[model samples]
Target: MEAYNFETAIKPFFWVASDKTFSVCLNAGTYKPEIFEWRKDEGFEGNGYDWASLAKVFLEEKRPDLAEDIRFDPEADMFCAYSENPDKLKEFITGFKETCENELQIQDLFLKAEID
Candidate 1:
């Protein structure tokens, strides 16, 4: 058996860049269901609930100073931002990674953390 790491696991997924750029990669998982699905039990339900909308929420929740710069790309099935910020990008990836790790079962998960 072989061990896996974050990059390898996420390599197959696409990333929503801040410049409204859609990175062609692998989609590990949406991690955020509420952003796509607007239902009470399903997840977050409010005025705005898509990726761009959620980005606003995340920005406000995290960076109040930074204005929300987000866009929705149906073709890519992801939300992107107009501003290019490393911290925001890292935060987004971290959130997605953490969610995938917590929600997905080890055996069910495609990406596994390296043992060593």
Candidate 2:
């Protein structure tokens, strides 16, 4: 079995709400075998949710295997996905961004801690 060290791996870019109530991290954009995580910001008290639906739909349609790894914690308002293939992850991320911008009508989001 192999182990992954995310901190040492390529850093992720985050998409966060304007109010900083929630965030989605696109871990290791093109870096192979990475993970994506989404969570509600600490101290947030709004009812806003569904941060993972678009990504989940994309994954389910394109990479069912990876979708199987999708995990959600409603209590924590978090979700995550682990993929061994970098290309596939990138595809999903692209779609996710587009969905967020167009379909979800979330325009206040922006990339955080982007890597060069």
Candidate 3:
């Protein structure tokens, strides 16, 4: 599989811009076998995986804390970005939903998923 670019990150993921604000969970493993199968078939690190860098950059803009590349973490488990700050994550997800339309196109398979 091609390395995920911002434009290609939309597939295999549905922004959980959701209530995980106890902490931000940018991506998580999926249990669905089909997804898992696809992930394995594609050599993905995990299901629901997203290209983490774009997410980090988006969050980096709003975050004021020390940052490191998740890739450097041997223990890194997230498929995208993660944050201890709920508000920052919300801002990131909301920003992606509210913006990025012109910058990306959800994989046609995800076209029906809400962008807003």
Candidate 4:
């Protein structure tokens, strides 16, 4: 199988909010990067299986403090996070890319019957 390069494959951009909070945005294929308000009407339906769930879990595991800042909008297919510290924001994005790559590997293995 060909290797997928996360750094070259996925690019993340930053948006500074009015309050000066640095927000990171990633476009995963068909998704367009945009700010989304938190939805109180709908509940999370991923149940730890989807990409959003995996990303949240990964962030929580790697950086609990930044995890709470994460937001994913399935309808918009956007993933975003806000951080006051630019360095922390950068770290989160780097970690996020790694998490995505790891998840992708597991998915590939499952599809290829290499894993049960």
lDDT of 1 by residue, 20-81 (tens): 34332232125444323323344423222233444444445444455443332322443334
**Per-model C-alpha lDDT, please?**
0.39, 0.37, 0.37, 0.47
Q: Write the per-residue lDDT of candidate 3 for residues 1-116, one digit (tens) a residue.
A: 87845323543334334454222333444322332333343454433333343344443453334343222111234544444564554445455443334334322222222211
lDDT of 4: 0.47
lDDT per residue for candidate 4 within 3-103, as digits (tens), equals 97534544643344546666665443333211011211243322222335545555656678876655544323444566667667667777766544574
Worst 10 residues of 4 by lDDT: 32-41
Better of 3 and 4 by TM-score: 4
- On lDDT, the leading prediction is 4
Off by over 4 Å in 3: 1-50, 60-78, 104-116
Q: Write the per-residue lDDT of candidate 2 for residues 1-116, one digit (tens) a residue.
A: 86864332323434333342333354322321112233224322211123344345555554576554344333233334334444445445555555444522332221221111
Candidate 1 wrong stretches, greater than 4 Å: 1-13, 16-49, 65-76, 96-116
The TM-scores, one per candidate, come to 0.38, 0.35, 0.32, 0.48
Q: Which residue pairs does candidate 4 place in steric collision?
A: none
TM-score pick, better of 2 and 4: 4
